[model samples]
Target: MKALLILAAIAIAIPSFSQTLESKQINYLVKFKSTRDLQTAMKKSVMSGTKANADQKVEVITEQMVLVSGKNAASAPLLKNQNIEYVQPDYELGLIETFKADGQDQKAQVMDYLMKNPQLMAKAKGDNPLIPQSPNSGAARDPLINKQWGMLDMGATQMWPVAKNNKTIVVAVIDSGVDYTHPDLVPNMWRNPGETGKDAQGRDKATNKIDDDGNGYVDDVVGYDFAGNDSLPYDKSVAAWQLLLGGGNPGHGTHCAGNIAARGNNGLGISGVAPNAQIMALRFISEKGTGVTSAAIKAIRYAVDNGAKVLNNSWGSMGEDASEPTENKALRDAIQYAESKGVLFIVAAGNGFQGKGYDNDTAARPAYPASYPYSNIISVAAIDTKNQLGKFSNYGVKTVHIGAPGVKIYSTVVGGKYSDQPIPFLAVWEGTSMAAPHVAGAAALYWAQYPDKTMAEVKAAILNSAAPISSLKGKVSSGGKLNLVNLMKY
Candidate 1:
């Protein structure tokens, strides 16, 4: 059963459309007063040629919210009905930063760099490329930990002892699917409990093709793929041809997942801030790194309904459009749902246009979800190892909450690989997208240490513990960069 919203409560102020729906067909998200009202609204649609026509095009995401693929001709009339609260286009959103430019491919640059530097590749493949970690230091022994300047700068070294052996918390990477099999991430991947054991018929629940957990999904051992609408949410990395034609993912979600909770001190790769946290992989963005609004909402709801305590939303619209507020209303509602469930939503402040930074405080249209006025939201900005805000990072003293290591970030990628900075086109990897998971992992780390804290309390501690930094001053709400040691102390 889907959750029912109170009649008196509208998800948010539904902004009126500037013009009538265009005649062309497109996907539109509609919010009806009730499930029963769906039929009544169709009856009232002037373009509803037939009941079957209406039924064929509608995809119900929730009892009240639906994704309709048809012209505004049918939906334009829906607004007249007092029961129909909101209707708007289902906008297509993509990665916060573009990876290709001027015939240069970011992935190509990475491959070229590796090809020219076989020695580095050889070292990458070595079982133990560096000196082993001293046991009493309480630091990770991962071969690449030294390259993780961001983690070290955030005080990961000092906090590791306290975070190690703590309760494992689940943090959902709500983006492209994760490479759950990555050597660095496999040990900390989330395994669905209900789908682990044998079924009533003595069949293995994980492979029995049954909804063993009774959670509307079948054998979701880790997480579901909302984009592909199937079970396996693996990160299908882009091929050479796909990149040439300008499409396919760059292991964005996998990198984010590694930052949140790659296994620590495992002697394989780097350690995340919360090495013990479990990464719940939820794929909403397609392989091309773009996703529709409905899919994003479903991913958020799924993360909350499951056991995820933190949601790392590293993708969003390039910028806010006041006229299209209704288009993203469903997004707000979904996030509100997470908030009601005591889940913290850590969002990227967004990389500005052309991969250059911008000030959200005075921009005509600021990045959203990050700019959204939600209590549970902790909008993050990107900063380099020097504690300087990334030139490509967006900032807002009031909107963006805090700063975190995002520039030249080193973490896990697809194909069981690790890179300090893979996509090299105009510093594509240096984005607030990378910054958010730092906070997400930190949230998990802090929560693990103090399980009694509420969502608001954890958020407060994280923000309050930010170390006042000159670069981030007057730019983010916290006026500082995240300090994990200070946060753990709090």
Candidate 2:
């Protein structure tokens, strides 16, 4: 009967979720009206006679959310604070890594190096020219590019020649920290014009003790790491192999960033979907692949305030499907704030095997934030090389917006830098997390070509251009998969 009710609510897209959800863990998101009100609220909110951590204090995470730690389910002290709007559990968000890293299989350092050089590549190929040699393998110059079927699936190469505008467009990879030093990724990172050299007060810009731009964070040159309350947002902590099934990876963010903007035509490594687009690394998740909901919200505001127009969120909360979609107001406020600021959010539809098996209609058993209603949000399902839905992907005819290639995708990892400073380590990854970025790259491509278009306009262009395939017919809202070639023609 409960299942029937949930399914019925999904069919109508009517939100029926009741109850303020929170984990048993000692953390919660408290929202106050203004920053000035935080001090008094903290005093009233801290529980007495508790064993919470002293380091856990009220950290003002965003304009609408605050991270309050050290409280048990025994008492809801945050709710007692004056001007406190709402407090919900700081839920755990998991990174969707469908496949573990197998490391790169290189052809040979000498041949690989020679093939990357346009001048040497022709001769290096000897008798064979560097063309789309065969359909079975898209191998061109970079050995791994051919293995990245997602690139070919979306027709990403067609825009490489003309999309110069992508460099100016910033797509924030809001997940684990990015490896800014990665060779294929280094050239394309977003430089902070506000925090580059010297502050208005004459402090050394890069290492100044002050918040150079008065943006709250001190010396956020690349991006801020809210999880650690620091500036470096590189993915650092990776759990072991058996732990991979649980969540967390050292190179997850780096992989996702590469999906959005790894360099193209460099003759090294795989090319990004929107190869020229700029990446703004926003690290809120930990090396352990877990983070509080408040941290994720802060990352979104940071991305929007820092001039990132498109945000790729390859993460989602761990929860089961209910009669109605779960709602997180504080998180929703942050997402809506970004959308209001003209940021397009490309989110991964949940992995089907999480707490809830959402392989069917995700709308009926919705995933938070993705299932959360917002026009600026583009919830993506995952598909394989054959254009079939991935076995692990979640879909919703009304909730998940579109499908994109997510299986066995080859992209950059942390162990290496660029070709010049090459300590290269690449891998073939999978997940709806991988799939969302493809749509993000597609959106970036469209946004780059028409820089002046509205987010709604860009969203429409992407959905309109999708190739309606039978495989995706009943599985997704679009009943089609993303078509970058068609998006470019639009």
Candidate 3:
């Protein structure tokens, strides 16, 4: 009878182990109103002495206030006492280990814990919208003469004349979705081999289907959309700015994309700095120009995981709220990861018209991610045709790294369109946002020439090649605008 009991116990244990093996780890994104609130919660959790067993490990990463742990029955009491806002489980892309707790019942427990903590939930709810409704309204088409002159006379000097163009290098443009069907861009767009679909003729097709490649994204033929979380075709909406202060503008991203790699010398309206390099569009910012730090982090990670050698971020914010610790750490970690993966990151120094003295005033301040420390991140400012800094461009000798042509510049637009307008072309759309891409494109040219150069070398080539601008002396680090003509010599 004793032997029979032992055999029954062993049989029950086997099934439990199988269930646990298939169980998935749960990730919880917790938000607090302020650092004070976040610290309070952490203190409470620690004082409560709610500890996990040897089989479970609870890691609360402060950067994003994320708590990751293996699924278990004990998570409920600890979460309940800590006042968590939302407990979204199994929302991550990949599969992980499971626990022996009741799956359905455990999910309910987690949800209930969140519901009981209304204050935490309210605080966690992000106010930053995915799209902005009333963005900076301006004329779309700039004059043709102005566009033409700016393209030819001002900094029209070619930078990649003698260097061997590196076709193997890939750049990831993380912004509003790219029109892959655009004639100038179709040939240069990146495609995922593992997730491509096929037609009846057995030819590869970009389709909208879920899990076709078992990568968790449905019909992400070109790239995955974190905003929508599904394969509905991404298009810019006018109302995207309400979520993020300066978001909800796809025009900015479209123009930047064209500058980097828009199929040069193909009878197109304008040519890119590196015509042969490939462009990968990663849409982290929605059509309405607004995005949170979390979404940006995910996009950075995605670009690094895939085959992006360079990453461009041309957006930022200015204010007291911009210096949140959680968001800062996330940006730092992401950039560090990119550096480790041998990828280069370029960001804008903001276009808020503020000087270096205005940063700590607590009024409208300079933007972040640009301010973060990562050797690979190059902060850029804007310069006009006269080789003088744009009035509205932000500058800091300690922070702003370099300057590039931004005023009256023309490049690619959405919907397979080209800006045919002339120099000083499209009236007055000038900002550091526009200038950052020039540096990014130049980086591509540098990468193509010295494929073996470390990130530091490529950075030096860009700074060392800048043309001296007397007007910008003492305002910018290199004290000049980028000179493509001089860069090719290296």
Candidate 4:
């Protein structure tokens, strides 16, 4: 047993202290050189369809940019077309929706143990009525509350006194989509404050086919869908990923959102870490669990342009699948954009490079968005109930900032459309995906406590407030997992 433990310690090597096109889009992002009028040039030379088989429709993502479709070999001449600066294939990005936050069996056993021990359950609830009662209690109004072990692990119960009233603080859940209809989640979904009974001329801003907020989107009362190019960012239903009764639920965004801000004290489903914080649903990933970087970029812009001060990214690339991590310019630029706007991006460290774990501190091995060097970003790794690093979580002592409870986390699964039988509890879901929101929720609370601080200050406070753990000393930069109790006191 001693030898096995030694080998396991050796393998972890913690010292590292570390697409866009749209759904099924075969596209490339091209920028114009020194172009003043990008749209005019694109219309005249490319999208006009008058330029020898240029019938392809182009989506102008920004000022001088275009996510052009209808080409694989067709972009070669266009790159040389005097007006074009450069172009590259719109790479397809996938979500890390699966990982080893410990197996569901382990989680089940833990729950059984807790169930047998009422002492632990009572201790988990402590004195936070803002946090609902645990499951299995005749008195537990919300049966799913006890199932939410992740909240207890991160000290969310302790943070509630400071955050239960700040409904104006918004965190962008940039993934598939959130089930806004979920009773536990609806009250906390971010509503466009600009949405009123009527515009100056009496036209309904929520329904009028006009850009009421002048944010370039029409009738986007909740959030925008970059994947389908629609106004509603609600998680669209999928037969395979639905959270059917007695079925394995897979609504990625909804699950993440629930972890961040599902309403507490409602005696309904599980409680969220930041129940008072609002969620701005941004659907960039498709129902199929894949999407292009362009859509993600657009979603980031939308979130920042809106009132989302903290961005919770539960999905990322498989860095181990390639020779090294791929640096995406459009996506990097989007992160920079958010940083410039005082928006803090909380991202997951990643599941693995490609099923092969590695140290993130080494430049040769890294994760996108999370590993990207930025002050506004807070990279997160997954830890189990034991406070030990998860076997499947990627860590970098210098890169991955902190750790959080992720194994078999229970939260709100998609109810309407996204689910078949409406499983109120998304039990046993795992990954760094579940961990990022724990930090996001805390960040929202911290921002509320210090609404005057800049995004950088909030990021630093969260990182500096982590409770260092011996097991994770060399695994994560903070050498600790999230401790909301410490965060609030700090």
Candidate topping TM-score:
1
lDDT by residue (tens digit), candidate 1, 368-422: 7778788999999999977889988899998999999998888998768887654
Runs in model 1 lying further than 4 Å from the true structure: 1-22, 35-50, 70-82, 103-140, 164-167, 244-247, 322-327, 424-428
Give the Cα error of residue 51 in candidate 1, in Å. Answer: 3.8
* Candidate 4 global TM-score: 0.79
Sequence-dependent TM-score of model 2: 0.77
Question: Candidate 4's error at 88, in angstroms?
Answer: 1.9
Specify the highest-lDDT model's number: 1
lDDT of 3 by residue, 119-183 (tens): 32331112222211112223222223235333343243344346566567777777655555555
TM-score of each: 0.84, 0.77, 0.65, 0.79
lDDT of 2 by residue, 1-490 (tens): 0111111111221122111322334466667767667665654445453323454455667655566665343134444455756555565565655323223433344345444643422210011111111112232455467767788777776666776645778999998888876667777778777777777778767677677688988877778788788877766744233222223454678888887888777666878888778888888877766665678878898899988989999887434324334355666788889878878999988776532337444344456556767889999988887888887778878778899988777778765532211112333466788889899888887888888999999998988888998888877877899888788888
> Which residues of candidate 3, in runs, are more than 4 Å off?
1-161, 196-205, 208-219, 231-247, 320-327, 353-364, 420-427
Number of clashing residue pairs, candidate 2: 6
Ten-residue stretch with the least lDDT total in model 1: 1-10
Which RMSD values do the candidates have, in order? 7.1, 10.7, 16.9, 11.0
How many angstroms is residue 479 displaced in model 4 relative to the true structure, after the best TM-score fit?
0.5
lDDT of each: 0.76, 0.68, 0.56, 0.68
What is the Cα-based TM-score of model 3? Answer: 0.65
By TM-score, is 2 or 3 better?
Answer: 2
